[model samples]
Target: MPNVTIYTTMMCPYCFRAKKLLTQKGVKFDEIDVGTDPGLRREMTTRSNGGQTVPQIFIGKRHVGGCDELFALEARGELDAALQAA
Candidate 1:
């Protein structure tokens, strides 16, 4: 399984959706909650190339962008390949 990491915040639907998709794929992920951690948020921004969003996802060091992008990967039938990239 790939090393999945997701920077998330509470009450964000996009974050929820991202988690749901990952769960449906049965992949374990490290979920960093930046809701109350400014430092983690900054880290997330740095990892995501200044993307300061609620759900900044990374799969095995690969920056996968946010929820919409993730779904786009699934639409393109590439999500499974990404998960296997670890």
Candidate 2:
């Protein structure tokens, strides 16, 4: 499996929903709580092409955008392949 990372905030429902979906899919991830750390939040912004919002997800080195984008990808049957790809 590729390295999965998610930049999230504690009170974001989208963040929680994203996590629930990943967990249901059995995808392990490294979560960075940007709400609690200003440095990490900036890092998230830089890594996300200026998207400072919560739930910026990366599968391996690929930026997968936010929760809605993720669901859209899943709906298109692309997310799993991207996640499982080498």
Candidate 2: give the clashing pairs: none
Per-residue alpha-carbon lDDT of candidate 1 for residues 14-55, written as tens digits (9 for 90 to 100): 999999999998989999999998999999999999999879
Q: What's the number of clashes in each of the models?
A: 0, 0
Cα-based lDDT for every prediction: 0.94, 0.94
Q: Candidate 1: which stretches are off by over 4 Å? A: none
For candidate 2, the 10 contiguous residues with the lowest summed lDDT are 33-42
Residues 1-86, model 2: lDDT tens digits: 89999999999999999999899999999999999888999899999999988899999999999999999989999989988988
lDDT (Cα, 0-100) at 14 in candidate 1: 99
